[model samples]
Target: MPNGQGGYQPIFILSEGTRRQRGHEAQESNIQAAKTIGEAVRSTLGPRGMDKMLVDSLGDVIITNDGATIMDEMDIEHPAAKMIAEVAKTQEDEVGDGTTTAVVLAAKLLEEAGELLDQSIHPTVIASGYGMAAAKAQEFLNDMAVSISIDDEEQLKQVAKTAMTGKKVEANVPVLAGLAVKAVKQVAEETEEGYEVDLDNISIEKQVGEGVDNTFMVTGIILDKERVHPGMPKSVENAKIALINAAMEVKETESDSEIRVSSPEELQKFLDQEENEFREMVAKIKEIGANVVICQKGIDDMAQHFLSKEGIFAIRRAKKSDMKKLARATGGKIITDIEDMTIDDLGKAGLVEERKISGENMIFVEECENPKAVSVLVRGGTEHIVEEAKRSFEDAVSVVAKSIESGKIVAGGGATEVELSMKISDYADSIGGKEALAVRAFANAVESIARSLAENAGLDTIDTIVELRAKHEEDGAVYGLDAHDGEVKDMMSEGVVEPLLVKTQAVSSGSEAAVMVLRIDDVIASKGNEVGEGGGPEGMPGGMY
Candidate 1:
């Protein structure tokens, strides 16, 4: 090290070639990295947004406009960008929609903060101001939210349709929306805290041969397994189903031991004893009067033969999830032991049939009286189409369930974002000084949602924002971007609605991520793995500035 006193001295703090960024440089670099990640997915923000086709290192391709999918598929290396991506993930996991809004909002907030930094404002002031603005934005959201009830099926369908608006299966949204509402409603449970929906109770299965319009909802569970034996009946009417978690095969001893049988007669006796046990197990199931058997584990060959002989429909290797769904749909108990099974343990369904779908045979337990567990079978023209359609359905189903559970909604199409921005800006004027600037920045950041939506729709963003801000200032906050015609319209009258839970989560998570990124003042990176000619610090591709 060179000393200021014109003397040479050796000193070590950071390891040689280790990178360090501190103070203003560190904050600026992190914000830029986060903004880059935000801009990467901002174009995929609304109903008219374009899709991103991300090709991974393995050449696997994902074409989607979903914010969560885009962020997850990208090979992002910057640590700050990864944090911003996590904000989208959190929003997706919590609300199942508004991922793009969350990301774009966070990015815009940092961009605004950077401007404040240039004007000599401190990062702590910006972070603090954002915290207050976030809390107030939540209040505005609650005030604007339209209360609904679980009985409002039409409103719930609108919520699903709104979520599916920008998806690839737009043509099938009406049909898919209906199925999504039905499935979520079937699985919803009433609790002291309003209604709670476990989306897991609603399953989505996809197959590729049919068109998107061919998708349908099953009242009961649809097991991917076919009948265990070809000799078994193809279908059973008035099914009394026995759900077994244990295998039908003869179970071996928990502790292994070698058996020595020198005589051929002794060997035949041992075989006879094992055969008798298998027969007894099947007989017990028959005694229970179960016409259909669903096993979570494998069934022995002899057991299958016996089941077929008794004219009982049997499906082996059923997934635990499917078995649980069966229990709910059929009102049956899952028997753990052969001796423990009884007639009362059997579940009832109108029919249990093995049907061929897309050239694959699958078991369908249909027409359960008031089934609590249901499934949606998604069909499309090709594998990729089916996958994309299924993804769209997942979003629809999740949002519908969320709406039913919360019983509250809001107008979408950037209406809510514009309203929030206006409200927060008014709030900023109430406060004074530099912190107010930060609060105002948060409000402006939120307005980027409307800007991005208009941009994605091929409209002039500046003109759209100017018109939207004027509309909010004069005519209240009902007006928003109408992507279809590139104009501002009332989202409420247009039936473009979303769950309140989605909007609240998006704003809160986005603000939190922005604040986190702004607070970072230091970054220390370890040495890179490879060394090359003319390489910068520790062989990093582009060394830290």
Candidate 2:
């Protein structure tokens, strides 16, 4: 080993078996791990991206096209891969639709950087240059973005249509498009002054079992159906509503004096007295017009039978909060005592309904004065599908809301960002300093997002990147480069801007996996002695950074 103080270190002098390695190798490994993870999902990129069926150890299945969901479910042990996962999560959490895109872009940027390194381009330098180019590219793309008036519904539709293309509901494009527009408009109108539309609010939930086809406004509880007992009421109407957090009947009362029941006659007398007392309580409720009852807990069979005979509509097993809501909604009182029940205490029955539409079940409630705030109980066919649909709907709603709130959607999926990075890189050689490297790094980051998305969606990041680059060259434009009309014309003459996401995530996860693997170098491990830690040296356990 070379002495720390100086000259060339002799490899032969060092113990080759030692695990310690160079920082460069570690960095390389991190980069490679990132690439490998990205490549795993490459083929599923773009509108035509493929779906993944994830079956867990329990044989539970999840079929989805969402990049984040897929990545999250995978049993990944690599730290770098986890970092890439974090990026996807960030995109999903922030924009709701760019997970795959971000991953693909990141992978491509890394791959390109690797090639540059092979050509003697320092990673630091390339990173810096990419940053500069990305900034310029962002400015250009921003400049190119066509701003429309707030009332331009057509333009908004165009944006949404672009996103919805080839999606599950593509067949209902016209309907969805109109709904999206309407939803956006509605959100905009309801928002406070200067409030923007948030598309996250526009989500879809599917359900099974008589589905949500017959949805209708409900002013009261939906457990109208009778309980599994003859004592249960068939229906209740024009009755007072009482919410009970406790049991309706009186608790078992101990006799103040212990009576000796040595004979059968004495026992019969006690039973008769108890029965009579119960009947008397039921009579009192009937007299008070307390025909409708909403209990947070269960009702005794005797009480149920009495209520049913009185034509009282009773709903037991109501949630405490929901029961309170019903009370508030109908200006009714909550009673815990069976004896306190009275005819006048009963409130009129509120309305409730359910419906199904578009293969989804919906439960609507009209308990609130503001109809817009009514809860829409969305149901799904399966847990996974339902969850994915919910996520998709949430994204749609959020995007719509945001577009309304901001008056427009920002060019997303880091498309605008990558373009900006590239343009900044174009002039990197002229500016000499750490700034150049920073610029390059920033550009790589932006591009990395695209590569990540492609990889997650199972597309060819390299080919896609190349295609994007070629399109820019042919059009005299760049991925994130935006130009004025004249500049656009020049670019057209030169051949530059080309839409690329569609082709990137359309490959195979294995291809993306391969690309990512090719980029690996260093492997960092943990230092803790956790039980599940894959047996390895501290800070060098699994395929992490």
User: Which lDDT tens digits does candidate 2 get at residues 402-466?
Assistant: 45554433343334444554665665656787556545544565556555444444556676556
Off by over 4 Å in 1: 1-9, 529-545
Candidates in order, TM-scores: namely 0.94, 0.59
Candidate 1: give the clashing pairs: none
lDDT per residue (tens digit) for residues 340-442 in model 1: 8889999999988999997898788999999999988999998778988998999998898888888889988888988898899899999998899999999
Deviation of model 1 at 110, angstroms: 1.1
> Model 1 TM-score?
0.94
What is every candidate's alpha-carbon RMSD to the true fold?
3.2, 9.7
The CA lDDT of each predicted structure is 0.86, 0.50
Best by TM-score: 1
Name model 2 segments beyond 4 Å from true. Answer: 1-22, 108-164, 173-193, 196-205, 209-350, 354-369, 374-388, 411-422, 426-430, 434-438, 441-545
Count backbone overlaps in model 2.
147
Model 1 residue 206 lDDT? 87
TM-score of 2: 0.59
